[model samples]
Target: MVINLSPVYIENSLLFANTLVMLAVGLTLTYLTTKVPNFAHGSLAMVGAYALFTIAAIMFGNQLSQLQLAQPLGLGFAAAFLAGAFAGLLEYLLVLRPLQKRGSTPLGLMIATLGVDLILLGVLNIFADILRGMNPVTGTTRDWRLKAYVIQKVAGLSLGVWISFGIMIGSLVALYLLLTRTRFGIAMRASIENPALAQVLGVNVDLVNMVSWILAGGFAGLAGGMMAFVQRINPATGSIEVVAVFAASIVGGLHSLLGAVVGGYVVGLSETLLTKILSDITGVNLVTYKRAVPLIFIIVTLLVAPEGIMGINWRRLFSRIRSRK
Candidate 1:
């Protein structure tokens, strides 16, 4: 069968996948370290997107070209990253940390994250309203408030594309190195695996948790900022994709970083490709129901292999095959 795919669809799918990778990594990392499914993770990304918007519109007037070395964008990126990290740190320090001290259950911590998510979303809406009142140099207040923003192009592709790809690649490399080559990484792994044991070994479990939240928050922020340029940026932008991000993490094995990365690509492609193929074949517009893709993945994964793709023991399977042979 000849399955002709449009280049635009493919490019968009990759872009979406890359974005999911960023968010999924953060979700998985947070879950690994805290053992809580942080529903507020996506809100942290949304905060980062707004940080980019604030820098580009209010701080720099959206005329970054006049700056040398594109420092404005650089500053904006830093601001977004920092904002995301701060949001995460704040959530942990203010809510999760206190709750942990009081011996809160994992389910309670997870519910707290939901509360944080609602609060953050409300704050974002208020911030957007404030932006709606400000008159920026670029366009109308509404335009500057929460509309889409695009970066300059290089080699005919928007700079946002390169930025997103760079963040994903750089994050992967940095995380791998941090986990495998650094003392902190070792501490983090020990803490995640056994907090009591790690603390006994002088690993500083609390410190590890703080650092992980910071890193996860930073990644989400960077992704959100890059995504704001590629798509529309509003208060709901981050919350809108939480399902896909969660699916990526869960399908990859919530405890496995590599699995999360692979799952992000899988869900990303399925969300786009499946919708297109099914729409074309069934003569029905399935694009509107694309959001259900992740839900389906979640259900299937729960039924078939609750541990997810990475949870499977490949070595044992290979050993059994060899023994039979």
Candidate 2:
């Protein structure tokens, strides 16, 4: 059966928005911990998606079971969430911490993260090959069925968009609570500011950093799982996704959660709209370039403002500055 790429792109645009949430969380964590950009964050997402694949295979083969979905979706989300922290732990213990101890500049730490990213990429490819070669259930068929869950077709699109908006609002509330109402959030901010000061003041700086990573990674994992459910995950998918996420992050402005959210919807709408426009305009098919729009926009945005559509005045930042002034 031949699948039209336009609808695939449309669906994938939604999937990308869902997945970008994970990347935004990651980008936010990196901004907090390392003060240097992380290019390898995409690799972690790849890992999360693969982890879902592995779990899905182990739990369900050649059969699409709701139970199977929950098993991986639930457990895998926990694991993915931890993956973020583990990444943070590695960044702190192996890369940033050591480099900072040696007086290595932030640029060095950033480069080191890129190195970690590449190393993980190679390792993941090896895993991919191994998984590909060995079919655990040697002759088992793969299940590619989409469960028919929704009943109303008339309002599905509007419903989905509303759900997306609700998620955004909920995330904002949760983030605010964490940042302002929780001790751990306070510690995270403090450690981001001055680890030595935080440590001297008895804030377990190392532990807080670890927690942040775990939280960020796990969130990324869950996001990836949600995406895999909505789309499909292969062993070796990369910039195919990172590009869209980069766009959303840029549009949302790199460090702000709200920016990421707004950026996601913008990219989602733009993806659908662009494909429609291109399909009509040049008569050249845009299925190939639909996903690429986000990346292209990211580059364009960076070249222009680079500060992101939301700017740096995060809600938290605004509240803090107002208090100070």
Candidate 3:
């Protein structure tokens, strides 16, 4: 069926997909390093968003023309990355590391991540209050969005879309080079593959894990900074959006970084498009329920292929299907 969608919606979907790619990759990397799903990962993204907001507010007073705001927002991306990296590192060093030393079970570590998420959420709320007191903007503490300020379009799409797409591609290429060409990357691979053996081989597994968290957090922050342009940013925005991130990571194959990339686009586009399509057919507004798409994907993936897309033996399955035909 031909489904005509608005260009705006399409652009938003692509932008959201790109952001998910970064978040999913980060989530997968951290999971690989710690063997635990970080419940606090989304909060890290929010930390980045707030960082961007802080920089923008300070430099431009949270209200400015597109031209005037552009520079600070551009610089805010870097600030966001550092802020997120710092937060992730602190989580690992201050919370996870101590718990690990005490022989915390994987479940315990997972719960600890949830605790960390709550702590981060509280901190974010407090930060929002501070921003409101300082700026006194209408939406400073809630429902912050910069969509109006992003007036420039590239190839008929928002600049944020191109920026997010570029960052995702660049991050993947950098990760590829880091894993394959660099000595440290090789060591990191070894550590992820087999920490005990890597440790015996004189690779500092702890350092590798620490670096992984930093990279993950930085990617998340970068994505969050981009998100401020396209979506509303509140303190709880990350927590609400993490459902899509987890769905992408799971659908992509939690154990495979490449899978995370694939899953991000798949889930992101499907969530946006499918919701639109269904809404049109049913004559009901479904944007509020768009998140249900990712939840369904998670449930279906777990039930149909617990190992995810990357875990399937495609060649073997195809051969079997051919034989049956």
Candidate that scores best on lDDT: 3
Q: Which ranges of candidate 1 are over 4 A from the true structure? A: 1-4, 59-69, 135-153, 313-325
Each prediction's Cα lDDT score? 0.82, 0.61, 0.86
Error of model 2, residue 44, in angstroms: 0.6
- In order of lDDT, best first, we have 3, 1, 2
Report, for all candidates in order, the number of backbone clashes: 0, 7, 0
- Model 1 agreement with the true structure over 198-285: per-residue lDDT tens digits: 9999999999999989999999998887666545666777777888999999899898999999999999889998788888878788
Point out the higher-scoring one by lDDT: 1 or 3.
3
Cα lDDT tens digits for candidate 2, 249-268? 78877767677777877886
- Per-residue lDDT of candidate 3, residues 1-325 (tens digit): 3466988888888888888899999999999987878888889999998898888767765446566755787788889999999999999999998899899999999999999999999999989987886553236666686566664787887777777777789989999999999999999999899999999999999999899999998988988877876788888888888899999999998999999999999999888877888778777888778879999999999999999999999999999999999
Compute the lDDT of residue 92 as modeled in candidate 2. Answer: 62
Q: What TM-score do all the candidates reach, one by one? A: 0.88, 0.74, 0.94
